[model samples]
Target: MQAWQAGAHPRSAPGLADLPFALGVASGTPSHQGVVLWTRLAVVDPLDPRVHTVRWELAEDEGFQRIVQRGQTETQQALGHAVHVELQGLPADRWFHYRFMVGDAVSPVGRTRTLPAPDSPAGRLRLAFASCQRWEHGYYAAWRHAAAQSLDLVVFLGDYIYEYASPRSGLAPQAATPIHRVHELRRAVSLADYRDRYALHKSDPDLQAAHAACPWLLTWDDHEVENDYAGLQGREGASAEFMAQRAAAYQAFYENMPLPASVLVQGLQGLNQADALRLYQRHAFGRLARFHVLDDRQYRAVQACRNPSESSAGTVRPSRCAELRDPSRSLLGAAQEQWLAQGLAQDSRPGGPRWTVLAQQTLFSPRHYGGASAAAQADEPTPTDPWDGYPGARQRLLHSLQATPPRNTVLIGGDIHQNYVCRVHADPDRPDSPVLASEFCGTSISSHSGATLERAQALQKNNPHVLLANPEQRGYALVELNPQRWQTTLMAVDQPGRADSALRPLARFVVEDGRAGPQRES
Candidate 1:
C-alpha cells in the first residue's frame, strides 16, 4: 500500500498548472468482476511521445482513510496520453470512490460500482439513459441534476459529441435558443481536432459532475463522426480521405471514453472500432434487467430516397420514393441481426430477466407523417435515418421477436430530440398488428428539435401506438427496473440555456410484468 498526504504535492512539475487532467476522470463498463477507470493527460504538446505517470486510488469511503485500491500508471503519448485502467477482482454491487493525482494536483473524485453477480436475484436497479448533447445548443443542466439522483449506472445512447462546426457558425437549427457558448475548433477532421472537440465538451462542469457520479455504458451515433454516415460512406460520399478521417475520429473517441481496451484495435487498414468493441453485447443486472447495447451507425446502407445535403432529408412522401421499401436495406447490419436473434431466443426462455432493455441511438418504432388523414400518411414515408427507413431490417427483427419475443423487452432510445412513449407492433401501420415491444424515446439533454411543438405532438395522432409525445422539453429519462415492473419517468428541463434549471418530471410510464407494452401511469 502507498502512503501519502491526500492533497500533498511532493513535486511540482512544469505545465501542470495548465490542467494536466483537463478532461477529468471517469469509470464505466463495469461488471461483477471489475470496472474500467479513465483519464486524459492534457498538456501543452498533446502529441508528445513521452510517457507521463498518473497515480490513482480507490476507496470505500470518500476520504483516503479507507483506501481500498491504489496504483500508478504511465500514459504514453502515442495513445494521446489517455489512461484506461481495467481493475478486476473488486467486490460486486457496491459503491466505490476514486481520484487521480499528478504531482500535487488531483482530479475530481468519481463514484462507480460493479454489477451484482450474473443471474443472482436482484432487488432494484436505478438506471438513467440519455443522449444527443450538442455542445452549442444549451447548458448541461440535465447532467448536473442527474448527478444528484441515486443512480447505479448511466447509459449514454450516442451523440456524445457533435462533429459539425459550432452552431454559432449558423449551421444549427434556426429556432434553437441562442448559443450559451462556443466549441474549441471547426468541424473535427484530424486526430488533434477531434481531441480538442472532446476537451471542449468535457470542459463543462455539469458534464464532469455527471461522469463523477457513476459509471456509464456508451455507444456512438452519427454526430460522433459526422451526421448520417453509413459505414465507410460519409455524408460527402466515401473515399480514402474520408476513411482516414474516420480512423482518426474513432481513435480519438476511444481515447476520450472509458471503454475497455477490447474496443480499441488497429487493423491492417487502420482502427476498426466497430469490429473491435463488439458493441452489440449484453449485460445483466443480476435478475432485474438485461441491457443490450446496439450500434446503429455501423454496417447500415446509405439513407434511401434522399441525399444528406437536401433540406427534406428527414421527411419524404413514400409515393415519390419507391426505393425506400427495398428489401435489401438494413440498419443493424446482417451479423448483428443474427446475434440479436439468438440473444432474444435465449432471453425468452422460461427463466429469463425480468426486463430486457434495448439501448441504442435513434428510434425503433415507426413514425409516419403527411396529413391528419390516414390516407394522407399512406402517401408519405418515414425518415430513413431511423428504423422507419429500413422496413426490411425492422421487419426481420420484428418477425424473430414475434416468434419468441424476449421477456418484457423495453426499447430506450435517443436522437430525434423528442420524448415519445409508444407500443411497437410488427407492422406500425396495421390496425390489428400484434404489439411485440414497448419503446420509450427520451428527448435531448440540450439539442433542439427543429420542428415546432405542435408539429411533434400532431404525430401522436398519425401513430395510434403512441401514448405520449413531447418535443418542446429538454432533459432526460429516469428509469427504475425491478422484478415486478419497470417505471420510466420523463424528466424535462424548462430552460435549456440556464445551467441552474431543475429537472421536472413531465410524465411517467410503467411496464407491468409479463406485459408486452408500457401503460400511462396516470
Candidate 2:
C-alpha cells in the first residue's frame, strides 16, 4: 500500500524519520483510561507527504521499559503532520509517561494523567491556570516554576500568541520581544508566518516542560487572531479579505497546538474550517471540581475603548458607551452564556461537583480603572476590553450566579497580566449584599506586570468590593480545593529576565463555606 493509504506503515519506506523533539509529546482532556497524546513532525519539505506511522507506548514509569498500553497511528501533512494518539484502558488518577516512534527514530517522552473516576472518593486536585505570555516582553519563568510543582493540569486562558507586530524601534527596556517575524511593522499574514510564530514561542524550554508535565486545557483570546477581534468585526477594520486571512491564522493555530481529534476534525474542508476549533469544554475532577473552558473572542462583541473626556475620577458611568450598553452585545455570546448558565445550574444539582470553575480569558469583574475623572483629565480613556465593557452581559452572568449560585463557583481568569482577588458581588455598591461568587484572576505567567503595588492602593480607594489587586507581578495562581474551602496561592517569579528565576509566594487567599468571596488568609 502507498504511504498515504490508511493502515500503511512507513517502516518499509526510505527516508522515514522519527518525530522531532521540538513538537514534544503531550496529552489533554484526560479521562479514566483514555487520554489524547499529540506531536507534530518537523517538515523539511511541504510537498513530500512526511507520512509516517508512529508508535506510542505509555507506562506507569518515566522509563517506558515497562509498558502498559501501546498503539500505532498514521500521520500525514493533512493534519499538519501531527500525531494524536488516544490511549485507553488506563487507571484513573495515575501518572503515565509516553513516547512516540517512527521507523528508527524515537521522540521525547512526556508525562500525563487521567481524571479520577466519577463518584470516586473525593481526592486532592491541584491545577494551575495562566495566560498572556507575550514573547517580546519577558521569558516564561512562570511556566518553568509550574512544571517544577507537580500539578494535575494546566489551563491556558488565551493570548497564547500576540497578533501585533514588533515595534520598529526595539521594545522599551521593560517590554517583551515579539515571537513572530515581521515585515513593514504589520501583523503576520500567511500560514507559514503563524506556524513560525508558534515555533518561536514553543522553542522556550519552560513552556515545553509545562506541556510535558501535565494535560493542558487551553482557549484563545483576541490576540490569537487580531487585537479585540469579535467574530468578523476587527478592532482595526477587519475586511473580508482580512477575515479570510484571520481564518487562515486560526487554522495554523490548530495545526500547531496539541488539540484532540474531536476538535481537530470539526469541519470538512480543512482543520481551520470551523470544525477544528475547540474553544470550550468541561472537565470534572472527580466530584471536587468542574471546569468550564470558554471561547470569548469568537462570540464576543467588538469592544470600543471609552472616551477619556466623558468620565469622572472614581465612578465613570459607562452606561452611555454604545458597546457597553448594547444589550445585544455579549462577551460570552448567547450560546456560550447558555452553556455557562447550564453548567452553573448543574453544579448546584445533587451529585454535581463542589466547585464550578470558569476557565476563561479576561477579567469577569466590573471595574473602571480609568479613575473617575477621565472627562476632565482628558486622558486617552479606559480600555473597555474586559467584563467592565459588557455591563449587560456581566449583569446577566452575575444574576445567573446569584439566582442559583453553585456550591463553590470560582472564576479563574487571565489576559490583563495582573493578579486580582475580588468578591463577585451581585451589587458592588451594597457593602453588606450577599456575594454571589468569588473571582481569582491569575497574573500573567510571564507577561508584563502592571503597577500592582501602586494600583492596589488606588483600587482600595475606588473599588471597595475588590479585596486585593496586584497590578505588578509575573506569576501563576495555584488553586487548592476541598469540600469546605478553596485555597489559592499566587506564586511569583523573582525575575523572569534572569536565568535562575526563583519563585516565591506573593499572597494567599481562602474562601470559607457560604461566603460569596475570598479573604486574604494568614
Candidate 3:
C-alpha cells in the first residue's frame, strides 16, 4: 500500500466543485479473509492534479451503525482518482456493507462477501456469468435482473466495454431494436479516451446495481482493449502506436475495475516493459467449487492465417492453412497453460474442490458454421479467431483434463454473442470420443448476433454434441452448484432496448455428479 500524506483535500481546494459518486462503487477478488473494495472520486475536472483523501467504512449491517473497519486512502489524477482498498483478516463467508466518504459526500453502500473457508465443506454456490455488454446495442436490463438474483459472485467473461466508435462501426448490423446509446469517443485510443469510455459505461444505473450486489470475478476478452487483438498485435498488426494505446487501455481498465492493488502494480510494470497485464486467476469457494478464471486475449498468439486485406479475423479452410494446425500455437500462452494444468490437477485430487469450473471467454466446443454436413464443414472456411483456429491448443487443454480424475467439471464462457450448451468431447473431430466435460457458453448481454434462431437450430443437426443453441436472445447464464448436481439457467431479457424489459428463462439444464453432458431439465 502507498503511504498517504496529510494534504489539502479536493473538497477544501478552492474553485473545485465536489460531485456525487457518478461512477458508483464495486467490490471483487474475494477470499476467505477479505475482498477488494473500489470507487472513483467523481470530480468536476478529471485532470485535477491534487491528491485527495477518501475515507471508507465497512460494517456487518447495511445501516453501518456498528462499523468494524474504517480507513482512509489517497487518490490522484494519475490513476483517474480511483481507489482500491484491499482489506484482509476479516471473517470468512460473511456479508459486509461498505461505502466511501469524501467530506460530506458518501458513495452508495455496496454489499460484498468473502468466500468460504478452504477446508470447510461448503454446501452450495450460486453464481451468474455474463459477457459482451456493448453499451450502444441496448439497455442494461440483464444486469438489473442479475442484481436481483442474489448471486454470491458474478463471473464477467469479457467485453465489459466495446471499443467501437458507434453501433454502425461494428462488424455486424444492429439488432431489430435501434441502438439506445452511443459512445463518448469515436474510438478509445489514449488514456483520457479510455477513461472517459469507462466512465460512460460505469454511469449505467443497472450496471452499478449489479456491481453493488456482490463481488465480481472478471477476465476480459478482446473488446476491452481492441477487437480481435492477440498478444501485442491488433487488428491492423503490431506497432509502437498500438502498443502505447494498449498500455493506456490497460491502465484505465485497472483504475476502473475492483481489482487488487497487486494486479495494478504488476499491470503497470508489465505495461512499461511488455505491454501486457497478468489477469488469469484462481479462486476457491471452500471445497465446493474452484473457479479458474482465464485471460484468453492478453497472451494468445495472433489469429491463424490472418488476411492482410481484412482488419479482423480471417476465415480459411484448414487444409489450405497449415499454420492453423501448428502445435506451436497457443491461446493461453505457455506459462498460463502450465499454471492451469497444475491447478486443475491439484483440484482433481482427493480433499480438493468437488467441482472444477473453467471460466473463460468464448465458446469451447467445436461448431460448424458452414457446409451441409459436419464432416464437410470441418474442411470448409472457418473463422480463425476461436478454438477452431487453434486446434492444437484446444487438444492440449483436453489432454490436461484427461490427465485429471473424472471430477465434476463445467466450462462456462461467452463471446460470439450466442448461447451454446454442448458436451465437450475429448476430441471434437471424433464423433465417438468420450465426453470430458459440460459447457454453457452464454449469450451476450446486449451485443447483436447475425445468426437467427432458425439458422442456430439448423446448425444443431450438423453439430450433434450441442444440446442447445439460441443466437437470437440477449441475456446471461445463471449457474447453481452443489455436490449432487450443477444447474444452469439461461436467462434472457424480452427486449434489449427497453430498460424495463422482463427477463425469462429461455432454457434450463443440469449435469449430474460424475456425468459430463448437460441434460435438459425444462
Candidate 4:
C-alpha cells in the first residue's frame, strides 16, 4: 500500500530552480510501493517566504546508477521551508538510496528499505533498537558502530532530544543537580526550534550514518514533550494553558519528524488528526518476524511523582501508596490496546510467522530494589520509571499475551538506559510454566548510565527475571534471528568522545525454541 496518496494541486512554490543551504534529507516509513523523503531549504539570511521547487531521485544503487522512482515538489517558507515527497511504484523488499536537490543546492544521500511481502515465508531478520541519548553527556559512538552493520530496521525508542537545557553537573546523583533557569530553557515549542534541534542532532556523524544506514520506526516518550505528561498536561501540573503549550510541543515534534503531511496538519493541537494514524502499527520483516510499535506516554494518566504526606504524620515525604495502581490507568490507551491485541492474535496464528516482536519503550518486567542494601538502591527514593510502576496496565498487557500465547514472542525495548535480558512471565515466580515471552532491552547509544557496578551487583541479585543487567555501559544491542534460533549481542562502546570508539561484546545471550528465557554467556 502507498504511504502517501498524492492529490492534484497547483504548484504552491517555484520548482527546484532556486534556494541555498539545502539542510537535510531523510527517507522514512518505507512501504511496498513508496517511501517518504524529506528536505528543508534554508535561505542564507532573512529566511524568505518564497516558493521553491525540489526534486528527489530514488535509485537501487548508491550512485543513482539505477533510478526506480523520481519526483519533483515545491516547498514554501510558510510551511517551514520543508519539502516532503512520497515516491511510489518502487519494488517491495528492496533497498533504495535517494537524494534531493533544490536550485543549486543538493541534500545528503540517504538509504531506506521497504517492508517484506505481506505473505512471505519465515526466514531471518536483524534489528537494532536503542534510546535515551543525551548529546551533552556523551558522543554517539554506539550509533556509529550500528550504522556500519547491515540491518533490516532500526527502532528508536524516544529521548531523541531532551527538552531541558544541559545539566550543570556531569552525573545524575550530584547533590546539587545544576538546573538551567526555567526561563532560559530552550524547550522546543516552534517549527524553527524543532528544525534547529534536528540539525544539531544530525550534525553528529554517527547519527547521520545511522539514519543513512536504515529506515527507522520511531515513537515519542516523555522527554520529547514534558516529563510524564498525560495528554496535554505538563510537568509540575496540568492546565488548559499547559495543554496549549503541549499542543505546540506536539506540532513542533510532528514538523521535524519524517511523518506524512496528514500527521503534520494537527497544527499545534495535541489531538489525533485521524483515528487511523496508529502510532502503534504492525510491520512484518519478510516472513521471519513481525514488529508491533507502541506509544505509552500519550495515553497515560498524569502521575504525581510522589504522593502527598498524610496530615496525621505531619511529614512532607511521599505517601506509601501513590495513585499509580489506579485500575483505570492505561499505557497504550483503549484504541491502541485493542489494535495491539488484535494484531498479536492475528500475527501469532499457527504457522503464521517465526517471531512476534514488540518494539517499544520501557522495561515490561517488574523489578524491585526496596530491600537492597546497596547505596544506589537505598539512595533512590522511588523505583525506576518503567511499566513496573503501572501494575494494572502491565498486567492487562501480560494477560493479553496469556490469552493469545504467541509462539516465540519476544519483547524488544529501549528507554531505561541499560542493557537487560529478562524472561517476561504472567507470574514471575513460576518461570518454568508455559513461558509467556522474553525481552531484550538495549542500553543508550550515549546517555547516562544507571547505578554503579558495585550497586548493580546487589540490584541484580534481587531481580532474578533479569538475566543480565549492565548499568555503566554505553552501547546498543544487536538481535540476530533465524527460523530455529535467536541470538543477541550486547556490544558496549568504549567511549564516545574519542573518534575511534570501538564496540566490544559485553555479553552474548541466546534463546532457542520452546525456551521461556535466555541462556547467558553462550
Candidate 5:
C-alpha cells in the first residue's frame, strides 16, 4: 500500500467526458512473488494538470468476490497520469485478476500470473517473441493471434513504436501491404510529442489485448529513440540538442511502460538527467529457464567507417576499413559484457536453469551479403548496424560462451524485418567451428522488408549455418520449452492489412536437450 499525494482528496467525485481507461491495462516483469500492474488515465484534454486519485484491486477471481489486496495511488500531469503498481509478497505460480478504479468508473479486468518458485520443479514454459511493430505499415492482426495463444509470457524485442510520421514517401518498394494508419506527428522531438505517439499506439485494441493477456519482458532497439542511435550519439553526431531529445524520449518511454518506479528513480539520480533509463535485466522461471533481457542500443559504439558527410549507419567493406577489426569497439559496453559473462558463468553451475535464453534485438549470426568467393566477400559491402559490423565484440561474446557453456543455450531476437533460423557458431566465419547455440530471429509485426524468397535462398547458399530464412511473411515466433526439447513454430499472417487475417505456420524447428543447433522439423 504505497501512494504519492500532494494534498487531500476532493470531497465530490470529478466528472469526465469519457472513460479514463481508454488506453487499457497491462502487466509486466513477473517474478516468483508478484508482477507489475499498469494503466494510464486518458482524459478529454491532454494538458490536464490536476492530481487524480486512482484505486486498484487484486483478486483471486475476476468477479471481485475474493479480493486479496487493494490500494490507492495519485497520478498527476508530471507522470502523464500513468499508474504502475508493483505487487510483491503474494502467492507464487498462480493466476490473479486486477483492475483500476476512479470515482464511479472501472477499468477492464486483466489476468496475470507469477513465475514458479526458483527451487520448485517446473516442467514447461510457453512464450511468444515479437518485434518491429510500425503502426503505419499494416494492421495488428499478429498481436490478435498472439493474444489467443494462451502464452505464459511475451518477450518483446523493441521497435514497439517507430519514430516516423504519416505520408511516408519512398516506402512502396519494400512495403507489401498498403498503409493502414498514420502517426500523429511528423517526428517525435519533445516529451509531449513522444507521449502522443505512444497514446496513439496504445489505442489499438489488439495491442491492448496482447498486453492484457499476460506479462511481457521487453527490451528496445534503435527506433524507440531514433534510428541507428548509439550511446549518446545520434545519426547526426553527439550534441546537447540530441541529448535533450533523448531525454524527452526516454521519459516518455518510461511513463508509457509497465516498468517499476525504481528504474525512473535511477534515471533521475543522474543529476536530474533523463538521457538514460536502465532497461537491461534478468528474469528466472523456476529452474526451467533464465531470460537475459539485454539492451544493445543504449551503450553501443558508433558504427565503424561511417561516412563523415552522412553520419548514419551504412554498408562498408570490412577489408578496406581497419576500424571494423578494432578490438576495442563493442556492441555491448564493457560493463554490460562483464555482467553477461558473470550471468553465463552462474547459469552453468549445478541446480541452475536448464535453458539459458538470450532475448535481445537484431540477428546474432554473421550475414554475408556479397559474392560467394572469399575475396569477393571481403571486398563486398556489409551493413554496420548488426553484429557483423563489430567482429571483435562478437568474438568476445562467443569466447565467453565457449569458456562457460550453459546447458541448451537459445538466442531469440528480431530486427531487419526477416525471419532467420541459424546455428550460432564459436566462429561464424569458420565452418569447422563448434555450434554454441541455436538462434531464432523473428520477422517484424507490421514493418516491411525488401527481401524476397529467392534472395533469401541465395543468401542461405552462401551461409550454410542458416537453416531457414523467410522474408515473404510477417508474424511472431511461438516457443515451447521443456526438459527434453525446445520447439518453435513460426506463425505467419495471410494478409497483414486485414483486421481478421488468418494465421498459418510458416516453418517449425526443434532443438533437443543436448544439441546446440536447431533441426528443421517441417
Candidate 6:
C-alpha cells in the first residue's frame, strides 16, 4: 500500500505527516506578475470532508530563508480539500520557489516563473510540450527527464489522466505483466472516484518532480472526464445524468489542476454545463512569442456527425460524410474563433511577436494515406478525432492565417502517439498551397502508437507537406525560441515502458525569421 493510503483513520486522528498535501505541489497559468499554485490535503480516508487550513509562501531562492510572498487559505470539503492560490504582484521573467503548509505538513518546493514584460526582447525560452499520459500505460520516465531539464514552462496539452476503473482495495501496478498498472475502481463515475484517481496518479515520484520543476499550462482533452466528450454533449448526447457526471468531473479537474480560480467549477450554470469551467486562454512572452491555448473540445459541434469517442468513426474521406464541408460548424465555436483571429491579426501587424504558437491538444496538420503501416496503406479513412475530422474549422483557421499570417507561426499539438513535422497549408490537397504556419506534433510521454517506422516512411512519401514522422517512439518536443528562429528537438525516449528509460535527441527542426516552413538541422 502507498504511504498515504495506509489506513482508515479519521481526519483529525492522524498527524499532519500522515494526513495532508498528498498530491505534491504544482503551479501554472503564469502572467508577467502572477501565477497559480496548487495542492490537495491527504488523509487516510479521503472521504473526510473537513476544513483544513493551508499556508503558502514564495521565495526568490530555493531555501526558505528569503521569504517573498506568504499567505494562508483553507481547503473546504466543497472543493475536495484542495487549494489554488492565485498570487499576483510579482516581478517579471524570473524564477521563484513556492510551497504549501498544512499545520505541520509541508509540500515539496516548486519552481515557477512569470512571463517577461510584454515589450521586452526576451532572449530564449526552453519550453517542453507534452500530452496523453495514461497512468496505466507506463512509467513517467519522460516527466523525470523533463524535470531535470529545468524548463521555464511546461505545456500539458491533455489526457492528464485516464478513466479506466481499478479495484476498490489494494490498488497497485501489477508485477510481471504488460500494461503494468491496475486501477482500483470501475471507470470513474462519481466525484469521489475521480478524486481517488487523481490522488493515485499524483503519488508517482516522477510526476511530482515534473510538477516541482516548472509551471504548467494545462487543458483537458476527453479522458479527464469521459472519452471523446465535447461541450454539453458527450460521446453519447448530453443528458441530465451526463451533465451531473460532467459537473462532478469538472469539479474534480479544477480541484486537481493548478489553474486559477477563474476557471473553478462553481455549480451547474445551465443544462449544457456551459459554465462548468473555461480553460482556453492566452499567454505571451514579451516580443518573443505568443501562445494561444485553445479549447477544441468544449465548444466544438461534436466531431463532424460521427462519434468522436470511437476510433473507427473518424479519419474519413469527404465521400464518407459530405456535411464536413459545412462552414457553419466550428471547432473553436464562433466567438473563440473570432477571438483567436483578432489576436492573430493584432500580432501579425507591424513588427509583432517573433513567433505565434497555438498550444493545443490534437494534431493540426494533415496526414494522408500510402504509409507503410498496414492501416496507413489500407486506404481507409484517416482519424477524424482531431482537426482532420473538422475540415471546415481547420480550413477557416488556415484561411485566417493566410490572410494575416503571423511571423514564424508554429502549431504545437499532441494526441497521436507519434511525432510529426509538417507545414500547414491553406489547401490541404495543394502541396504548393501558401504555407500558413509550421506544425510540430510532439509524440506521447508513454501512450501507445500502433504504427511502425516503415509505415511512417510511406506516409512521408505520400504526404508532401509532412517532412518527418516517427511512429514507434515515445517522448516530447524540447522547443527553444530565439529572436530569429524557432527550434524544436524531438526527444525520443529509448524505452517508455521502463522506469529507467533515457531521452535521446532524435532530430531538430528550425524555422527562421519570416520563414513559413521548417528546415531540419542536423
lDDT of 4: 0.67
Misplaced by over 4 Å in model 6 are: 1-19, 166-177, 234-238, 265-272, 307-312, 315-317, 370-380
In order, the Cα lDDT scores of the candidates are 0.81, 0.72, 0.85, 0.67, 0.84, 0.80
> Can you give the TM-score per candidate against the true fold?
0.92, 0.87, 0.94, 0.85, 0.94, 0.91
Q: Candidate 4 residues 219-278, lDDT tens each?
A: 777777655555433334435555554555565555556766665434434243332233
Q: Which regions of candidate 3 fall more than 4 Å away from where they truly are?
A: 1-18, 167-177, 234-238, 265-269, 370-375
lDDT of 5 by residue, 269-335 (tens): 3512422677888899999999999988888888898774574688887777888889999898888
Worst 10 residues of 1 by lDDT: 1-10
Candidate 3: lDDT of 254?
Answer: 91
Clashing pairs in 3: none
**Superposed model 2: Cα runs more than 4 Å off:** 1-19, 171-186, 234-238, 264-276, 304-320, 370-382, 450-452
Off by over 4 Å in 5: 1-17, 168-177, 234-238, 269-275, 308-311, 371-373
In candidate 5, residue 22 scores what lDDT?
A: 75
Clashing residue pairs in candidate 1 are: 318-381
Backbone collision tally, model 4: 3
Question: Alpha carbon lDDT of residue 6, candidate 3?
Answer: 15
lDDT tens string, model 6, 372-436? 34455344475656887777888888888988887778999888888999988888877877887
Q: Pick the lDDT winner.
A: 3
Candidate 1 at 458: error in angstroms?
1.8
Clashing pairs in 5: none
**Residue 154 lDDT in candidate 3:** 98
Instruction: Summarize candidate 2's per-residue lDDT along 1-522 as a digit string, tens digits.
Output: 000111122323343422354556668878766788887765544446647677888888987778888989877765566677777778888888988877667887789998888777566778888898776666778888898888888888998877556555443343344222222224666666666566556656788888999998888887777566665553244355566767677776676666765764455254334324656888888898888998887776656443333321122345444554677778887888998888888888888888888888888875645543435223323446677667778888888888778887888898878888888888654556778888988888666664557767786656667777887778899877777888999998887665358889999999876676899988
In model 6, how many backbone clashes occur? Answer: 16
Candidate 1 lDDT score at position 185: 68
